[model samples]
Target chain A: MLSVDIRKTLGAFQLQTAFDAPEGVTVLFGRSGSGKTSVVKSIAGLLTPASGRIALGARTLFDDGSRINVPVHKRRFGYVFQDSRLFPHLSVRDNLCYAARVSDRGGRSPDHVADLLGISHLLDRRTHALSGGEAQRVAIGRALLTEPDMLLMDEPLASLDGPRKAEILPYLEMLRKETGLSILYVTHNMAEVARLATHIVLVEEGRVVRSGAPDDLLTDPDMVRLLGIRDAGAVLSAAVTAAPEDGLSELAISGGRLFLPAVEAPVGATLRVRILAQDVILSTTRPEGMSALNILPVRVLAVRRGDGPGVIVQLQAGHDRLLARITRRSADALGIAEGTECYAVMKSVAVSQTDIAVGLQSGL
Target chain B: MTDWLGPEEWQAVLLSVKVSFWATVLSMPLGLICAMALARGRFLGRDVLNWLVHLPLVLPPVVTGYLLLLSFGRRGPVGSFLYDTFGITLAFQWTGAALAASIMAFPLMVRAMRLAIEAVDPRLEEAAATLGANRVRVFSTVTLPLILPGIIAGAVLAFAKAMGEFGATITFVSNIPGETRTIPSAIYAFLQVPGGESSALRLVAVSVVIAIGALILSEWLSRRVAKRISGA
Candidate 1:
């Protein structure tokens, strides 16, 4: 676990944040200029906080009271920046081995890391010759070869386009699952937060507004304002129950089996599916003869009204939590409130391939 | 090549190459240090140091030579100290000619190297540090290789300038046959006597060839390193 409590003054902005990253993927989620990067830089020792204590596991990395500040190199945390800062002078192979060679400690071989990141063929290529996605992958491989105690990624996928992001997301998921290394990933992308974050730290104006498991924080109606109501959603853990037929695959969730766009995972493979709040429709009674294929019996956990005409309703569906953004008039007519019984209906085609992602493996 | 010129002319050509080679080689380490300091250091007297490094470039070569003669001539403070300590002599010798050439060439060398060092991105060094490299390792692994082409360019420019150095060489070391008579001084000597224009012309041609060759070499070397860096 990495603990961070730092206060810094940059120009007119004041950054005061404190959070703990456990042995899973802890995401620092925030909009730009929110001091998310500052927090990560503080942990990497690239930026010093005015007064704070930062500890990783049993070792103290930084403490202003004790006047102890470890330099960046000795901190031994692999950092991947938003831009792929590969040495233009080195081949992909050399860049991957740079950390290992400089630290004079052998960890994974370059070939092995390249294979894991699907960059084996690019080993001999120069850094400038790589595409954006390929370069980012090589950057990740370079970081991993250090065999660091933890990995720090600051929006590693932000520079890539949609297809490119899709290319690297699976590797990121695999890295966390295979290494089980504590990763502090910083980004503002909602899909990435839903897909990769095992733990979420919502940062606003240089402060941590909330920090908790993705299931709870993502579904919390109060967090919708911070998460951007349009992108706010819930991640439901489910196992593949059947192969694709008619372009839809069946996944067994706690509430019931759900049919979504064809998921590439094999039957019995568990994954997380993100259902946007805007995509869910609430009805007090089960609607008959409807095109929507999913209807789960749920009890209203909370009804939160914003200043706009919409109301965010949090629903408890069996053992999982779901959220629906309904119009104020619809909520009034349906009498949706805490403990109100309803059925959360969702169109089968609303969830796209980007919404389905690999969740944290049990006990990892 | 020897049959094309008289023995004295050939000797002058060889002496010029020798002086310029030593001048460029000897001054490189100091040149690199000064360039890095000027490019990255923020300490006190940095501006003064920058001005001092460029003084020889703007000052009249004769005045710069006089200053060198006063400080480094035999029986002078630094010259005497070296003589008493090591029994080494530089004034009126080939070594003094190399020293004058290097002094005249210092500004060009430092400017080229400084530009190159300034062009390097500090972010790359930070990335290296985050990857477990200390300050020295970051410089050696990332900074040095990136600035190598610039260093080569500086060395070549200094070499060309040293090959053409005349005013300072004459004042500091004076002309001496087979000792300090580099091509430029030899050309002057040939022009002072009747029926010596052909020899001066031959030495001039030799200097031009050497200068052009150095430029070509620098260009090729820089391109090769750049291609390796940018992969283009």
Candidate 2:
């Protein structure tokens, strides 16, 4: 387990956050300047918090009230900065081997990490000559070669384009499945959070406002407001119940069933689907002759006022609550309120296969 | 040109080369240490230390030589201590000429090295620390290699300055034949005579050529080292 409880005051900004993350991918999700990087720095022993303690597994890395602060070199946590920060003086091969050579772990080789990160072909090239995605791969390989107890990645994909991010995501998934290394990933992208995060810690202005499973947290309307409309959504884990004759796939979520456009997963395989808030429409009654394939009976749980003249309705669909944002005028005309029955309509094509990620149970 | 320069001129040229080479070799490490301290070390009276290191650059060379003589001349405190303890003398000696040359070149060396150290990114040091390298190892591995170009540049500047040092050397260690009479002092002595103008002019040309050669060598070394580090 990696546990952090630290408090630091930098000028007017005060950071006091506490969380215990089991050995998997625990993501720190927040907007820019939200002190996520500060927390990572404190864990790496680069920044000394004013008071509190940090522990990795059985080791007490810092306890400021007791005057205990481990030096950075001995912490043994692999840190991958947003910029990749590869040493320009070294080749890709040398960069990967550097930490392993210096680390106390005896005889750890660079070839192991290179193979895991799929960077063997780029080893001999200089770091400056690599593309952005390739540089990030080399950076990941360099970090893993240290044989660290945990990996801390701070927005490693923020600098890449969409194609580059897609190119690297599968490798990250492979790393998550293959290695038993615990990872603490920080990113402002909700898609990345849904794809990689097992446990999510939502940080806002230097404080952790909420923490829970990614599936539950993504559906919360307050989280939607925090994440903004462009990226807000509900993450649902579903098991493929049947591959229907019409080439569509039937998956069972908590309270209802969803039919996606077409899924390649065999029956009984699990997939995660993200239903965007903007793509959902609500009706008081089950309407007939609608082109939308999935419509679930739901009860209005709460209504939240969103920024810029919009209303966010929280609906209890089976055991999960999903958020739908509509204009305030639409909410009033449709009478979206607490304790009202409604049908939540989501188009079949709106269920993006790219949003569907297959999670491995192995701890990362 | 060969006929114009005689055997005495050759001796002065060879002696100057030897003295300047030793002077540069002995003081280069000290220059690096002083530059590091000035650029990165934080402590009380750091500004004073910076000012003291650069004092030789602003002060008259003759005054600096006079101060060295007062402190290191025979019967002077340090000079007498050295003589009594180890039978060594500095006043009017060839070693004294080297000491004068090193002092004159020290400021130039420290300034160049300071700029180089300042150019290195401290973030790289922090990155090294995260990779399990201690402070000393980081310096040897990261800091030293990055600042090597600057160090070479500073050494070359000091060497060129040491080769041409005249006022301080003549003042601290008087013009003694074959011991303290370097190329510049010899040229000065020859110019004072009735028929020694041509020889003095020839020695001046030789000094210019040596300075230019040192500069070109430093430039090539800096480019090579920069390419290696930056991977361009």
- On residues B1-232, what C-alpha lDDT tens digit does candidate 2 reach at each position? 5566798898898889888988888999999999999999998988998888888888998999998899899988999999999999989998999999999999989988887788777877887788888999889888898888889888898889998998889889989879999999999999999999988988999999999998897777667566655656
CA deviation > 4 Å runs, candidate 2: A240-252, A255-269, A358-364, B1-5, B223-231
How well does candidate 2 score on lDDT at residue A101? 81
Pairs clashing within candidate 2: A181-A364, A255-A318
The residue-level lDDT of candidate 2 at B102 comes to 92
Q: Give the TM-score of chain A, superposed on the true chain A, for all candidates in the order listed.
A: 0.97, 0.91
**Chain B TM-score against the true chain B, each candidate:** 0.95, 0.93
Error of 1 at B221 (Å): 3.6
Model 2, A1-364: lDDT tens per residue?
Answer: 9999999998899999998888689999999999999999999998999999999989999997778899999999988888887877788998887888888786457887787778889999998899999999988887887788899999999999998998888788778778767899999998888788889999988899999887678877777768878788777777889987787889888869999856777788777787888878999989799888899999999888855788788888988777787889989998889999999999987776576775433221
Per-residue error (Å), model 2, residue A208: 2.1
